[model samples]
Target chain A: MKFSDFICSKAIRHELSAPDKEGVIRELTGALVAAGEIAEEDLESIVGAILKREELGSTGIGRGVAVPHTKHPSVEKLVGTVGVCADGIDFTALDGENVELFFLLVSPPDRPGDHLRALENISRQLRDDMFCKFLKQAKSAEDIQTLLDEADGDQFGP
Target chain B: MNPSEANKTVVVKNPKGLHLRPAGVLAQLAAAYDSEITLTKDGLTVDARSILDLLTLVATQGSELTVAASGSDAQQAVEALSHFIANDESDEEE
Candidate 1:
């Protein structure tokens, strides 16, 4: 799926100011709350759930990618955010590398299929080395979206 | 992938087959188990443990695929996974 399908402009953080895991999560999830996709009161719980899921297993699949996801009852539909950290962060990837591209996914607990499908969509597209390189170099939200748009066209279909 | 689980293989008998949709379904069932699940296709082995990894296999229509799970519940995994593969309805969810 393209960025247009799931990622809103607010969800795309071109220049993340957060320096650590908690900081980065707060920064990304706060945008989701501001965009009205999540409730202000639910932000802490959402982030907590995501952290807890990470404790179970690192979503960092390596190759400069991390897909942190959790299914919560508070969410009624599949929602996600994408953050590009050009400065890089220590995400403890399976391949023992840092992470620069992060996809945070929150889905309704009832919709496992939707969650998997969304993750599958992202993971499959990220498999393209050239696309990942382009995304890593993207400097603006529009640039990131454009890369995703082109990658979506090339990888999935037009 | 162990051959003990290897003996238990199922073909994509569903009319719609194990395309993106059905593969997603199989992946879901596979995830519920604690075992390491691996799907083999055309000599390539994918971590059935991961829905994303399973999708990478891209099992198409009438593709011959094998789903093997090894862990505490390997037998249950094989039973449930085989059932999931065999029960093929185009609109099935989860």
Candidate 2:
């Protein structure tokens, strides 16, 4: 559930160039597949499932954050990717603001504990205003990963 | 498959019903299933796969719900979700 346990190093896009929801999901899925976390064939289905979930309500939890996730058969274990958008995208958040931080998660189709843990981890880290501010200012993927490492260590008491 | 045949239905027995907290628990439980799951309540069905969709159902106390799971792991999904409601983990703080 910790960021270090799941966030993909290669999949971390410091500043995503996707302009819309679908495009962003594709970008994330491609990253996951390339990272060997998800099967390429399951990319569309996973994205579709997450989008369907979004229809119920925006994952956008406010303060420019969105956690779009799904439990799909393609994943053998819990996997996640983080993206920071410098320009941000309109995610129809409850707070009526654009979302710049996206945490995309995919877990095994039968791992409820992992899902909750991931949610808890994401929610806990996002609650830190300073951590989020540092994440937003990160200029590269390595920089963002470093920020997450520090944040994860602080939250988990490692 | 007919939704009813997918699995035995379980009614919401919790005193406060399937509010946000219970819904979160159910959503968490549903994520542990490989089969496709759906929760039917108030004549509407929501994808149990999505935590957000499950939350929107918001079935109150005494509201009956049908938890259906399809595909190879149907039985397992039914069991997990049924146990989730039966255990009444809604009262626990996140």
Candidate 3:
């Protein structure tokens, strides 16, 4: 799955200002709501679910990334947004490093396939050092989206 | 010429498959050893030291994967990862 397949382009943010993990989750989830990708009424629940998932274990999978995700009945479809915090947020990741790239995902409880495929795409695409480097360097939302576009176009490795 | 490698096949017991949390745990455990570790699902294999590579397999619950490691500490690395996947419990499966 490509970023276009699930990522809401309108929801992507660059230079995120949220200073903490919980703030970042709420910030990114709010972006989805503002972008009209998810229901405004479901914002609190989605944020709560993602936070709860974080409690189980930080989604900060290391290498300066965090994929905060949860399966929620409130979302009929898989919705995702990206946030780049140049300053980084302490995620208590497995590597115990701060995270700069945040991919917050909320999917319907029933569609495990879409959720898995989205994650597969993210991980596969992130393996490319150039892609990861360029994404972290992106100064604007369009720049990030362009990179995602390039990644989807096969400009990067599998 | 190469050092002996350690390998074992383990069944994924968590109903949710090797999703984020477990994959993260498996990656951390693999990284603890000096050995290089890999997990193979079906015919696809990925570096067990990276949560990213591990997630790519999308190995579902009930799937069988082979954990392979090579280095002086291969056996210990392989055993730890395989056991974790095989015995991952009920609470976290959800």
Error of 1 at A61 (Å): 0.9
| Model 2 chain A poorest 10 in a row by lDDT | A109-118
Which runs of model 2 end up more than 4 angstroms from their true locations? A155-158, B1-94
Best first by DockQ, ranked? 3, 1, 2
lDDT of 3 by residue, A5-110 (tens): 8899999999898889999999999999999988899889888888888999889887899999988887788889888988888999877888999888888886
lDDT of 1 by residue, A1-158 (tens): 44566666667887888887767778788878988889999999989987876765567766788877677788788888888889888876655688898888887876655665566577678766777788888889888878777766776322
Best by DockQ: 3
DockQ of 1: 0.13
Candidate closer to the true structure by lDDT (higher is better), 1 or 2: 2
Residues B1-94, model 2: lDDT tens digits: 3233366567776655554345655666777766788988778787775544664555555567788888777887888887776657343221
| Model 1: per-residue Cα lDDT over B48-68, one tens digit each | 655456655545445677767
Task: DockQ for every model, please.
Answer: 0.13, 0.04, 0.60
Clashing pairs for predicted structure model 2, backbone only: A110-B32
Better of 2 and 3 by TM-score: 3
